[model samples]
Target: MEKWVVALLAMSAYLVFAFIVGVLAGRGRSFWSVSEYTVADRGLGLVLMWFLMGGTVFSAFAFLGGPGWAYSKGAASFYILAYTCLGLLPWYLIGPKVARIGARKNFYTMGEFLGDRYDSRAIQVLVGVISVLAFIQYLTLQIKGMAYVFNVLTEDAIPIWLGALISYGIVIVYVATSGVRGAAWSDVLQGILMLLVAWVVGYTVVYSFHDGVADMFRGIEASRPGFLTVGAEGSGMSPMSYTTILLVSVIGFIMWPHLFTKSFTTTEKKIKQTVLVYPLFAIFLVPILFIGFAAVGVVDPAQLTGPDTILPHLVTHEMGASGIVYGLIGAGALAAAMSSADAITHGGSVSFGRDIIQPLKPDLPERTQIWIMRLSVIAIGTVAYYLSIFGAAGLVQLLVGAYGSIVQFAPAVYGALWWRRGTSTGVIAGLVAGIAVNYYFQLVQPATPLDINAGILGLIVNVVLFVGMSMVTNPAGSRADEYIKA
Candidate 1:
């Protein structure tokens, strides 16, 4: 067989395997039960929870953007490693609390949890809207990654639109059918596959063009001084900027609706266990950064269209001679993209059904609710796919912009668990204020004062509003006390 054909077959084989596994995950489970579909009846074990959390957190960004950052920004890429290690530490505390409340309340979505705490349909709908918006943007980036992988590995034989549709279509099917279980099981496979591929590519590249890891860094330092040190002369970001971004992520990382909702999928002890072992996933990412650094002097920066293309470029130009290598790289990239996309798609559908639609039609039957959620999987996935293929030229910017607003949920979430004085009025007011301030700073005037992230500035305003408004308003009283005691 021809080289491209062989590569395509290898990638195709992986996709087929993923589809079978995802579809089978729902078997013998209660398809009609909302609890079964959304949280697998809250029975997930340690192994499944570990991979689900690990795979979802380490998305296509780990494969593509991680290398891209290292290739373009040098030590600025270390910020990813730093945040990944620290982001889930907060979860160790937050996750168990959330799981306790989630089990007591029978909550399956963040909107549901927040809405019940605040006793307001308005807050629920607002969270649903914000979550869906962020989900689309986040899913768009993953779809784009999947398409890029297929197109580049096949030498452009598969068009961007078709590649995205094919990869994400399978994701949609499994998500609609098997729901969270499908996503969790597939992630186990994907997490393992991508880790292996990352090591293979990272190690091969480091040794292919250089003597060794030490020699590679020595050569880079001698040629380009300070490139490996952030805030240094050649570094891409300032010290203040890096520090603030890291701080914001540590708070916002668990606040993501998809991740927050995971608390309901397993026991509190399992949730804590997952967070404990999560740092190992960060260690696996070290090799991905190696690939980008290996190409620093070898690949011509001027020849590439964007830094994100560095991984594919290296695979095509350097490893193209071996069909097996090309196929594995393609599969690895697709795994990274699909693993996250499945979770986002499942979360979006559940959010749409429980958070947005259910509140609007509170009288809807359970069967109708499940049907709506199933159909929502297709509806949300279709929209994300369209945006990925035809939306703005800068989709990554959209994800960054959405993140600023996601962090706005921190005050409301933390307040619900710890502060008896918190009220629905205060939570709603604070969320709106924080999102508005975040948008203004992030998109309106990105050159934030003091080189700090716009999200942090928004958070400052949010906390002030949250605390002040709560002080003046009536407390949630017994309801708030119940959650705190949980």
Candidate 2:
């Protein structure tokens, strides 16, 4: 068999194993209950929570986009590391509170908590809409990443559309059957495999090129002067842009529905302990960056067709006919894609079932809601599969832009937690204004009026509207007050 075929088979085998493990993980449970399906009865321990959270965050973007950015834009790529570290930092404090409240209230979705806190179904619907949209976009990136890996490794023998369908189809099946429990268990396996692959790739690049880390930097300096530093000539991004991107990601990371919903799955103490170990998860990314740096000076950026393809190109070129390395890389890439996709597919289903469907039909049976959620997994997975096939060139940028709207939730969420005066009117108005501003800025101009991210600009306007409108409106009544204190 061809090396590509062997690699593809290895990846397929790993995915099959993951599905088996996922199915087995939830074996004795009654998935008919929303609590069992959505949040695993809110009883996860630290180890599973750590891997699930870390694996979801360190996605295909981390493995694929991190290196791609570093290879193409130089120091600006450090934004990946910066944003990741800073993103999880806030969770140490915020997560425990969310977990405590969510567990107490039996909140399976973030929308449920937000709505209950504000005593407004409108807030629930709004959060649900945003969560679904952002989850779809996030799923699109993972699907695209999987397609790119398959296409590159197979040299287009397997078409991108078919590749996406095959991989994402498996995700839908597993997630539909097992929900968050499956996603978490599969993530543990994927996380370990991908980490090992990252180290191997890093070492291979260094060894093959006959260069240590110091020598690699020296080569980059000689060929691409100031490449180690930000704002060098030929670097595609400005320092200001880099800093703002990092800021946006740091602030926006936990706002993701998949990550936030995980708060509902574990205990408060477990959540805090998970945060303690998450920084160590960030350290696993260093080797992935080293792979990108190794490509510099060795592979000309201009010669590469697209930044996402850089890693695959380097692997195939460097490893030659070594079937084992190729298989390992393919498995790692598939793991990254599968781990992320499963969480998103599961999260989206929960949002649709718990927040959207139940609210529309309050009398619906819990078993029916569970079935609807299972079907939603397939529905959402299919939509994302098609979108990934037809979407833009840079999967990471599209993901950032798509999910950027979630940051608008910061005001509503924080206010619900701390501010007693925040009203439903203010939250609705602010979300609309923020989304409108963010959309206009993204489509009309690449940068905001002041060179900040469009989302940041929108967030400023969102906050102003939220605060301004809250002061103008009547304070949330005794129920809202009680909910906040609860």
Number of the top TM-score candidate:
1
Candidate 2 C-alpha lDDT tens digits along 87-190? 87777767778887887778888889888877788888888888888889888999988888888787678888988888888788778888788888988999
Off by over 4 Å in 1: 393-396
lDDT of each: 0.89, 0.82
- The backbone clash count of each candidate, in order, is 0, 0
lDDT, candidate 1, equals: 0.89
Best by lDDT: 1
Residue 95 in candidate 2, Cα distance off native in Å: 1.6
Per-residue alpha-carbon lDDT of candidate 1 for residues 38-91, written as tens digits (9 for 90 to 100): 999999989999888888756887788888889888998898898888888878
Candidate 2 backbone collisions, by pair: none
